[model samples]
Target: MNNNNISIQDRSKLFAVRAIKAYTELNKRHFDDAGKVLAKQFLRASTSIGANLAEGEFAQSKADFISKYSIALKEASETRYWIDIMIRSEIISENKFSSMIDEINIIIRILISTIKKLKDK
Candidate 1:
């Protein structure tokens, strides 16, 4: 696989870029202290997904790739959780929450499928 192609690797790099931008915007919006904490956590978890995916691509074996991608999937789920909490707490709008959650869900599914396929090899 060509790592130079940002569109490859399950669109992980794209998702990470968008998530970082959104997190930056959210950080700059000056929410309450509690909201700020949740936002920071969410950003960290969301960005980790792409980082883990990149690592997985360079993994030495199928098992290693699966392990790394599994972590990415877990991080994506954590991001979704934080987004849901933030939205429910009124720290962020419903639209923003839904969009982020959808992206996270997509990533999670992609990672899960990739792991399963690798295991079957």
Candidate 2:
């Protein structure tokens, strides 16, 4: 498939966008010192999704693409981890945390399936 044919609204891209937005909003809120550490980790992991996706797009081969996407998948998982920590620590409310986690979970599944399909080809 041609890269230009891919829409920015694709699940992977959309999830990354949502993650970045959520992290930016979270960063604006004041937090205790301990909470701040989780916040920073959350921001980094969330933003890494898109950054890695961009790298995947420019991959020189199928293996390179899969490698970059695998990194994105890992980042999504990491984002989920930090989100869980934030919710359990009361840094973010259950409702907000759950929504973000749901999105990340969906993205993870999509990435996994895509990787599998590519590997099979």
Candidate 3:
């Protein structure tokens, strides 16, 4: 992801890129039985964050837009949960995920803020 200021869509796409790359490494480095399940969940939730946001761009109505954003937020939360599980389960290292954790946190916060703003408007 670039350091410059960017829209949520662009940021999310960049995040997805990083996440896909990490998913490949996760599969290679931690392919144990439980690790497979965790990695799949992680990939689904992480990618859904962007996929939902992208879908929201073409929402048919304001309510639909909020719904899609809400879904993205939910997926973001799930992604965090999977990450925590992976760390606790020793499927991945904490230090190695610090940056992605930071990125996901920012994405989650942004999703929350956007949802609130849309609802208020």
Clash-forming residue pairs, model 2: none
Question: Candidate 2, which segments miss by more than 4 Å at Cα?
Answer: 1-10
> Residue 35's C-alpha lDDT in candidate 2?
84
Best by lDDT, which number?
A: 3
- Write the residue-wise lDDT of candidate 2 on 1-121 in tens digits: 1233454226556666776687688778887888888988988888788788888888999999999988988988999899888889889887976767777777777788888999999
Best by TM-score: 3
Q: Given candidate 3, what's the lDDT at residue 22?
A: 86
RMSD of each: 3.9, 4.4, 1.3
User: Distance (Å) between predicted and true CA of 76, model 1?
Assistant: 0.7
TM-score of each: 0.85, 0.83, 0.94
Q: In model 3, where do residues sit more than 4 Å from their true spots?
A: 1-4
- Residue 75 of model 3: what lDDT? 91
Residue 113 lDDT, candidate 3, scale 0-100: 93
Give me the displacement of residue 43 in model 1, in angstroms: 0.9
Report the alpha-carbon TM-score of model 3 versus the true structure. 0.94
Judge candidate 3 against the unseen true structure and give its global Cα lDDT, from 0 to 1. 0.88
Worst 10 residues of 1 by lDDT: 1-10
Instruction: Tell me the number of clashing residue pairs for each predicted model.
Output: 0, 0, 0
